[model samples]
Target: MNSLPKRIAKEIERLMKEPVPGIQAVPHDDNLRYFDVSIEGPTQSPFEGGNFKLELFLPEEYPMAPPKVRFLNKIYHPNIDKLGRICLDILKDKWSPALQIRTGNFVILREKVLLSIQALLSAPNPDDPLANDVAQHWKENEPDAILTGKDIVRFSVSEKMDLGIRQAKVD
Candidate 1:
Protein backbone atom coordinates (compact mmCIF):
# COMPACT_ATOMS: atom_id res chain seq x y z
CA MET A 1 0.00 0.00 0.00
CA ASN A 2 1.25 3.46 -0.82
CA SER A 3 2.07 5.56 2.19
CA LEU A 4 -0.19 8.60 2.59
CA PRO A 5 2.62 11.15 2.26
CA LYS A 6 3.98 9.53 -0.87
CA ARG A 7 0.55 9.35 -2.46
CA ILE A 8 -0.12 12.99 -1.67
CA ALA A 9 3.27 14.03 -3.03
CA LYS A 10 2.65 12.18 -6.27
CA GLU A 11 -0.75 13.79 -6.63
CA ILE A 12 0.71 17.24 -5.99
CA GLU A 13 3.43 16.67 -8.54
CA ARG A 14 0.89 15.61 -11.11
CA LEU A 15 -1.32 18.63 -10.45
CA MET A 16 1.66 20.99 -10.70
CA LYS A 17 2.82 19.52 -14.03
CA GLU A 18 -0.54 19.37 -15.78
CA PRO A 19 -2.92 21.59 -13.86
CA VAL A 20 -6.59 21.68 -14.61
CA PRO A 21 -7.56 24.76 -16.59
CA GLY A 22 -8.54 27.58 -14.23
CA ILE A 23 -7.20 25.61 -11.33
CA GLN A 24 -3.61 25.64 -10.04
CA ALA A 25 -2.13 23.83 -7.03
CA VAL A 26 0.96 24.69 -5.04
CA PRO A 27 2.39 22.95 -2.00
CA HIS A 28 3.49 24.79 1.15
CA ASP A 29 7.20 25.07 1.66
CA ASP A 30 7.22 22.90 4.76
CA ASN A 31 4.00 20.92 4.38
CA LEU A 32 3.88 18.13 1.84
CA ARG A 33 0.35 17.06 2.68
CA TYR A 34 -1.15 20.47 2.37
CA PHE A 35 -1.51 22.42 -0.88
CA ASP A 36 -2.89 25.78 -1.92
CA VAL A 37 -5.11 25.88 -4.98
CA SER A 38 -6.68 28.64 -6.95
CA ILE A 39 -9.77 27.95 -9.06
CA GLU A 40 -11.13 30.47 -11.46
CA GLY A 41 -14.85 30.85 -11.55
CA PRO A 42 -16.31 28.98 -14.47
CA THR A 43 -17.00 31.16 -17.45
CA GLN A 44 -20.54 32.59 -17.55
CA SER A 45 -21.05 31.75 -13.91
CA PRO A 46 -21.55 33.92 -10.85
CA PHE A 47 -17.88 33.50 -10.07
CA GLU A 48 -16.59 34.38 -13.49
CA GLY A 49 -13.43 36.49 -13.29
CA GLY A 50 -13.45 35.85 -9.57
CA ASN A 51 -10.46 33.98 -8.23
CA PHE A 52 -11.08 31.70 -5.26
CA LYS A 53 -8.49 30.16 -3.01
CA LEU A 54 -8.80 26.71 -1.48
CA GLU A 55 -6.73 24.82 1.04
CA LEU A 56 -6.38 21.08 0.52
CA PHE A 57 -5.12 18.69 3.13
CA LEU A 58 -4.45 15.04 2.40
CA PRO A 59 -4.78 13.04 5.53
CA GLU A 60 -2.68 10.11 6.71
CA GLU A 61 -4.94 7.67 4.84
CA TYR A 62 -5.18 9.72 1.63
CA PRO A 63 -6.78 7.58 -1.10
CA MET A 64 -8.75 5.73 1.50
CA ALA A 65 -10.01 9.03 2.85
CA PRO A 66 -11.08 12.11 1.00
CA PRO A 67 -8.84 15.14 1.12
CA LYS A 68 -10.25 18.01 3.16
CA VAL A 69 -10.64 21.23 1.18
CA ARG A 70 -11.78 24.53 2.62
CA PHE A 71 -12.34 27.81 0.87
CA LEU A 72 -9.65 30.26 1.83
CA ASN A 73 -11.34 33.16 0.12
CA LYS A 74 -14.48 34.88 1.28
CA ILE A 75 -17.00 33.82 -1.32
CA TYR A 76 -20.69 34.40 -0.88
CA HIS A 77 -22.18 31.24 -2.30
CA PRO A 78 -24.95 28.90 -1.30
CA ASN A 79 -22.79 25.86 -0.78
CA ILE A 80 -20.05 27.65 1.09
CA ASP A 81 -20.40 29.01 4.61
CA LYS A 82 -19.29 32.42 5.89
CA LEU A 83 -16.51 30.65 7.71
CA GLY A 84 -15.23 29.18 4.41
CA ARG A 85 -16.45 25.64 4.83
CA ILE A 86 -17.51 23.90 1.66
CA CYS A 87 -20.57 21.72 1.55
CA LEU A 88 -19.69 19.14 -1.09
CA ASP A 89 -20.71 15.51 -1.08
CA ILE A 90 -17.33 14.16 -2.08
CA LEU A 91 -15.68 15.93 0.81
CA LYS A 92 -18.33 14.71 3.17
CA ASP A 93 -20.93 11.98 2.89
CA LYS A 94 -20.00 10.66 -0.55
CA TRP A 95 -16.26 10.32 -0.14
CA SER A 96 -14.86 7.02 -1.32
CA PRO A 97 -11.54 5.25 -1.20
CA ALA A 98 -11.42 5.23 -4.97
CA LEU A 99 -11.33 8.99 -5.35
CA GLN A 100 -7.99 10.77 -5.71
CA ILE A 101 -6.75 14.35 -6.06
CA ARG A 102 -6.58 14.76 -9.78
CA THR A 103 -8.58 16.48 -12.50
CA GLY A 104 -7.48 14.51 -15.54
CA ASN A 105 -9.56 12.19 -17.68
CA PHE A 106 -10.49 9.70 -15.02
CA VAL A 107 -13.42 8.92 -12.78
CA ILE A 108 -11.83 9.60 -9.43
CA LEU A 109 -9.95 12.69 -10.48
CA ARG A 110 -11.86 14.58 -13.16
CA GLU A 111 -15.38 13.47 -12.55
CA LYS A 112 -15.20 13.64 -8.78
CA VAL A 113 -13.19 16.78 -8.14
CA LEU A 114 -13.14 19.32 -10.97
CA LEU A 115 -16.49 18.33 -12.43
CA SER A 116 -18.11 18.59 -9.03
CA ILE A 117 -16.65 22.04 -8.43
CA GLN A 118 -17.98 23.18 -11.78
CA ALA A 119 -21.32 21.71 -10.97
CA LEU A 120 -21.32 23.57 -7.68
CA LEU A 121 -20.76 26.82 -9.53
CA SER A 122 -23.42 25.97 -12.09
CA ALA A 123 -25.90 24.85 -9.47
CA PRO A 124 -25.32 25.40 -5.82
CA ASN A 125 -26.54 22.50 -3.71
CA PRO A 126 -29.08 24.29 -1.57
CA ASP A 127 -30.69 21.11 -0.37
CA ASP A 128 -27.52 20.37 1.57
CA PRO A 129 -25.88 23.69 2.25
CA LEU A 130 -23.41 25.15 4.68
CA ALA A 131 -24.72 28.69 4.36
CA ASN A 132 -28.35 28.83 5.25
CA ASP A 133 -28.99 32.41 4.18
CA VAL A 134 -27.35 31.86 0.82
CA ALA A 135 -29.41 28.74 0.28
CA GLN A 136 -32.64 30.43 1.24
CA HIS A 137 -31.85 33.35 -1.02
CA TRP A 138 -31.04 30.99 -3.87
CA LYS A 139 -34.21 29.00 -3.34
CA GLU A 140 -36.45 32.01 -2.97
CA ASN A 141 -35.06 34.13 -5.76
CA GLU A 142 -35.51 31.75 -8.67
CA PRO A 143 -32.99 33.46 -10.98
CA ASP A 144 -30.28 34.62 -8.62
CA ALA A 145 -27.50 32.17 -9.46
CA ILE A 146 -27.78 32.73 -13.21
CA LEU A 147 -28.08 36.46 -12.74
CA THR A 148 -25.29 36.45 -10.21
CA GLY A 149 -22.64 36.01 -12.89
CA LYS A 150 -23.64 39.31 -14.44
CA ASP A 151 -23.90 40.98 -11.07
CA ILE A 152 -20.21 40.49 -10.46
CA VAL A 153 -19.46 42.46 -13.57
CA ARG A 154 -22.00 45.13 -12.72
CA PHE A 155 -20.72 45.57 -9.18
CA SER A 156 -17.28 46.22 -10.52
CA VAL A 157 -18.56 48.64 -13.11
CA SER A 158 -21.03 50.88 -11.25
CA GLU A 159 -22.06 49.28 -7.94
CA LYS A 160 -25.58 50.27 -8.71
CA MET A 161 -28.57 47.98 -8.92
CA ASP A 162 -32.29 48.46 -9.24
CA LEU A 163 -33.15 45.04 -7.92
CA GLY A 164 -31.73 41.72 -6.73
CA ILE A 165 -29.29 43.57 -4.55
CA ARG A 166 -30.76 42.24 -1.33
CA GLN A 167 -30.25 38.69 -2.47
CA ALA A 168 -26.58 39.37 -3.04
CA LYS A 169 -25.88 40.02 0.59
CA VAL A 170 -26.01 36.76 2.49
CA ASP A 171 -26.47 38.61 5.77
Candidate 2:
Protein backbone atom coordinates (compact mmCIF):
# COMPACT_ATOMS: atom_id res chain seq x y z
CA MET A 1 0.00 0.00 0.00
CA ASN A 2 3.01 2.27 0.44
CA SER A 3 1.25 3.71 3.45
CA LEU A 4 3.14 5.61 6.08
CA PRO A 5 3.47 2.50 8.16
CA LYS A 6 4.73 0.52 5.19
CA ARG A 7 7.31 3.12 4.29
CA ILE A 8 8.54 3.22 7.83
CA ALA A 9 8.67 -0.55 7.86
CA LYS A 10 10.79 -0.50 4.75
CA GLU A 11 13.19 1.98 6.27
CA ILE A 12 13.40 -0.05 9.44
CA GLU A 13 14.16 -3.20 7.50
CA ARG A 14 16.91 -1.51 5.58
CA LEU A 15 18.38 -0.13 8.75
CA MET A 16 18.41 -3.51 10.41
CA LYS A 17 20.27 -5.11 7.52
CA GLU A 18 23.02 -2.48 7.56
CA PRO A 19 23.14 -1.61 11.20
CA VAL A 20 25.00 1.47 12.29
CA PRO A 21 27.37 1.69 15.22
CA GLY A 22 26.70 3.35 18.63
CA ILE A 23 22.88 3.30 18.36
CA GLN A 24 20.17 0.97 17.12
CA ALA A 25 16.53 1.21 16.07
CA VAL A 26 14.23 -1.72 15.61
CA PRO A 27 10.49 -2.25 15.27
CA HIS A 28 8.62 -3.40 18.38
CA ASP A 29 6.80 -6.22 16.51
CA ASP A 30 3.51 -5.03 17.93
CA ASN A 31 3.86 -1.64 16.25
CA LEU A 32 5.83 -0.95 13.14
CA ARG A 33 5.18 2.76 13.33
CA TYR A 34 6.89 2.76 16.69
CA PHE A 35 10.55 1.87 17.13
CA ASP A 36 12.59 0.89 20.15
CA VAL A 37 15.95 2.59 20.17
CA SER A 38 18.89 2.01 22.44
CA ILE A 39 21.79 4.39 22.57
CA GLU A 40 25.10 3.62 24.22
CA GLY A 41 26.24 6.41 26.53
CA PRO A 42 29.11 8.37 25.10
CA THR A 43 32.52 8.14 26.69
CA GLN A 44 33.76 10.85 29.09
CA SER A 45 30.18 11.56 30.15
CA PRO A 46 28.28 11.03 33.35
CA PHE A 47 26.01 8.65 31.46
CA GLU A 48 28.81 6.34 30.38
CA GLY A 49 27.83 2.65 30.62
CA GLY A 50 24.24 3.76 30.97
CA ASN A 51 22.11 2.33 28.19
CA PHE A 52 19.05 4.44 27.46
CA LYS A 53 15.88 3.22 25.77
CA LEU A 54 13.80 5.48 23.60
CA GLU A 55 10.56 5.36 21.68
CA LEU A 56 10.47 6.75 18.16
CA PHE A 57 7.23 7.25 16.31
CA LEU A 58 7.10 7.95 12.61
CA PRO A 59 4.13 10.11 11.83
CA GLU A 60 2.18 9.83 8.62
CA GLU A 61 3.91 12.88 7.29
CA TYR A 62 7.39 11.64 8.03
CA PRO A 63 10.34 12.54 5.73
CA MET A 64 8.69 15.91 5.51
CA ALA A 65 8.80 16.24 9.29
CA PRO A 66 10.73 14.84 12.19
CA PRO A 67 9.61 11.73 14.04
CA LYS A 68 8.52 11.96 17.64
CA VAL A 69 11.16 10.64 20.02
CA ARG A 70 11.00 10.22 23.78
CA PHE A 71 13.23 8.52 26.26
CA LEU A 72 11.86 5.49 28.08
CA ASN A 73 14.56 5.57 30.71
CA LYS A 74 15.22 7.94 33.56
CA ILE A 75 17.93 10.48 32.77
CA TYR A 76 19.21 13.47 34.70
CA HIS A 77 20.21 16.06 32.15
CA PRO A 78 19.57 19.70 31.42
CA ASN A 79 18.15 19.16 27.95
CA ILE A 80 16.15 16.11 28.94
CA ASP A 81 13.16 16.47 31.22
CA LYS A 82 12.57 14.13 34.14
CA LEU A 83 10.00 12.46 31.92
CA GLY A 84 12.74 11.82 29.30
CA ARG A 85 11.50 14.28 26.73
CA ILE A 86 14.43 15.66 24.71
CA CYS A 87 14.73 19.34 24.00
CA LEU A 88 17.01 19.34 20.94
CA ASP A 89 16.71 21.85 18.20
CA ILE A 90 16.63 19.22 15.47
CA LEU A 91 13.92 17.27 17.24
CA LYS A 92 11.90 20.36 17.89
CA ASP A 93 12.27 23.77 16.32
CA LYS A 94 14.90 23.16 13.64
CA TRP A 95 13.88 19.93 11.95
CA SER A 96 14.15 19.91 8.21
CA PRO A 97 13.72 17.56 5.25
CA ALA A 98 17.43 17.73 4.58
CA LEU A 99 17.80 15.64 7.70
CA GLN A 100 17.06 12.07 6.78
CA ILE A 101 16.28 9.58 9.54
CA ARG A 102 18.21 6.65 8.15
CA THR A 103 20.05 4.19 10.35
CA GLY A 104 23.32 6.08 9.98
CA ASN A 105 21.62 9.39 10.55
CA PHE A 106 19.82 8.14 13.63
CA VAL A 107 23.02 6.76 15.12
CA ILE A 108 24.87 10.00 14.50
CA LEU A 109 22.11 12.06 16.04
CA ARG A 110 21.90 9.80 19.08
CA GLU A 111 25.65 9.94 19.69
CA LYS A 112 25.75 13.70 19.29
CA VAL A 113 22.83 14.27 21.61
CA LEU A 114 24.26 11.94 24.23
CA LEU A 115 27.55 13.85 24.13
CA SER A 116 25.68 17.11 24.59
CA ILE A 117 23.71 15.58 27.43
CA GLN A 118 26.96 14.53 29.10
CA ALA A 119 28.17 18.09 28.88
CA LEU A 120 24.87 19.33 30.25
CA LEU A 121 25.04 16.93 33.18
CA SER A 122 28.47 18.30 34.02
CA ALA A 123 27.14 21.84 33.66
CA PRO A 124 23.39 22.09 33.61
CA ASN A 125 21.40 24.71 31.71
CA PRO A 126 18.26 25.58 33.56
CA ASP A 127 17.33 28.46 31.35
CA ASP A 128 15.03 26.17 29.33
CA PRO A 129 13.80 22.83 30.55
CA LEU A 130 10.82 20.57 30.19
CA ALA A 131 11.00 19.94 33.92
CA ASN A 132 11.20 23.28 35.62
CA ASP A 133 11.69 21.70 39.02
CA VAL A 134 14.74 19.73 37.91
CA ALA A 135 16.21 22.84 36.38
CA GLN A 136 15.49 24.82 39.51
CA HIS A 137 17.05 22.14 41.68
CA TRP A 138 20.20 22.11 39.57
CA LYS A 139 20.51 25.84 39.67
CA GLU A 140 19.77 26.31 43.37
CA ASN A 141 21.16 23.20 45.05
CA GLU A 142 23.77 21.67 42.77
CA PRO A 143 26.75 22.78 44.81
CA ASP A 144 25.31 21.41 48.03
CA ALA A 145 24.29 18.20 46.32
CA ILE A 146 27.78 17.77 44.91
CA LEU A 147 29.33 18.36 48.30
CA THR A 148 27.07 15.82 49.96
CA GLY A 149 27.35 13.37 47.04
CA LYS A 150 23.58 13.21 47.11
CA ASP A 151 22.88 13.78 43.45
CA ILE A 152 25.86 11.77 42.29
CA VAL A 153 25.13 8.23 41.17
CA ARG A 154 28.59 7.28 39.98
CA PHE A 155 27.96 8.57 36.50
CA SER A 156 30.77 6.71 34.79
CA VAL A 157 31.30 2.95 34.79
CA SER A 158 35.04 3.44 35.19
CA GLU A 159 34.38 5.69 38.14
CA LYS A 160 32.39 2.91 39.74
CA MET A 161 35.22 0.44 39.14
CA ASP A 162 37.75 2.85 40.62
CA LEU A 163 35.56 3.44 43.66
CA GLY A 164 35.16 -0.30 44.16
CA ILE A 165 38.90 -0.80 43.98
CA ARG A 166 39.56 2.00 46.45
CA GLN A 167 36.99 0.58 48.87
CA ALA A 168 38.46 -2.91 48.49
CA LYS A 169 41.94 -1.59 49.23
CA VAL A 170 40.65 0.23 52.35
CA ASP A 171 38.66 -2.76 53.51
Clashes of each: 0, 0
**Candidate 2: where is the Cα deviation over 4 Å?**
1-10, 101-125, 137-171
For 27-62, candidate 2 gives per-residue lDDT tens digits of 667667777887766655555556667887767787
Q: Residue 81 lDDT in model 1? A: 88
Q: Cα lDDT of all candidates, in order?
A: 0.68, 0.62
Q: How many Å off is the CA of 124 in candidate 1?
A: 1.0
Error of 1 at 125 (Å): 2.0
TM-score of each: 0.74, 0.64
User: Which candidate number maximizes lDDT?
Assistant: 1
How much lDDT does candidate 2 score? Answer: 0.62
Off by over 4 Å in 1: 1-4, 101-115, 144-171
Which residue pairs come into collision in candidate 2? none
Using TM-score, give the best candidate's number. 1
